[model samples]
Target: MRLRVQGLYVMDASKRSAHGNAYFTGFGKAKRIVFFDTLLEKHTLDEIESILAHELGHFKFGHVRQMILQAAIIAFIGFAALYWAFGSETFAGWFGLPHDPGVVLIALLFAKEPVSHLLHPLLAARSRKNEFEADDFARRIVGKEPMISALTRLTRDNLATLTPDPLYAKFYFSHPPVPMRVAQLRGAVEA
Candidate 1:
């Protein structure tokens, strides 16, 4: 079950953030695996290899495609709302939105900001779920203990917020918190 793909690209991102990351870029056969230089520098060979295993798991399970589809659907819904708003005077009147078409973009942004905040938790939950699936994929490839070690190492080296505010993490985090991910991996190993 070899996962076939394209190149691996390493990036220097230490100046931007205290973090280690790996991502799959491009699409289909052109996809490239990317690694932060900090990640290569900080982690052991096994840890880095386990991280790659996890990324491959994402591709194997089509998580990347699912995310793209989800994003497109959300964007479509947003555009549909805008189309309806622009076409109906009664809808515009209900919101007291300015009739000036040029200012609508700015007005829409202001209106959506608060609404986006309310949607943040749901979005974060979906993203965390995807991370868990990827972790499961990694675990299957590298074994749970190694996957846990890799995730833990990434968190420590990146100086991740170890004890984030629960509410804030729920609303903002794309990946599950480090300890939580480690525990999940441990649970998988036990089971």
Candidate 2:
């Protein structure tokens, strides 16, 4: 069987941010992996390979499409809610705001900001689940040890807090904390 691999791009972002990150970019078969050059500098080769395997897991599991679908659904719901609110006299009277496009735009921005903050726990949880799945993929390909090492190094290099407030993490973090991730991999290895 022939194996097909997509493009890998290394980005220069050392000047922009202290943290290094990676992403899967492009669409369809053209799907590519983009990594910060700093990631390569800071992690070992095995760690990098493990990280790539984790990204491959995302592709194999079709998470990109699922996330895009989820975003589309959220957008539809947001638009529908705005439409309903714009038509309701009570919304205007309670807020004492006029019905204007500019007003609508401002209201939409501010209203959704709060709603997004309110919904953060759920959304972040979903993202963290996906990260776990991807990590599992890495474990299968590169073994648990390599993945755990990679994750630990990545967290350290990125300066992620080992222990963060549960509420703050639950609301904002897309990936599970480093200790939790390392422990999960360690558990799998022991199993």
Give the per-residue lDDT digits (tens) of candidate 2, residues 66-103: 88899999989988988877777565556688876567
TM-score of each: 0.88, 0.86
Q: Write the per-residue lDDT of candidate 1 for residues 26-77, one digit (tens) a residue.
A: 5667878899988888888888878898888778767788878878987998
- The TM-score of candidate 1 is 0.88
Each model's lDDT = 0.79, 0.80
Best candidate, TM-score-wise? 1
Backbone clashes counted, model 1? 0
The superposed Cα distance between candidate 1 and the true structure at residue 72, in angstroms, equals 1.0
- Root-mean-square deviation of every model: 2.5, 2.9
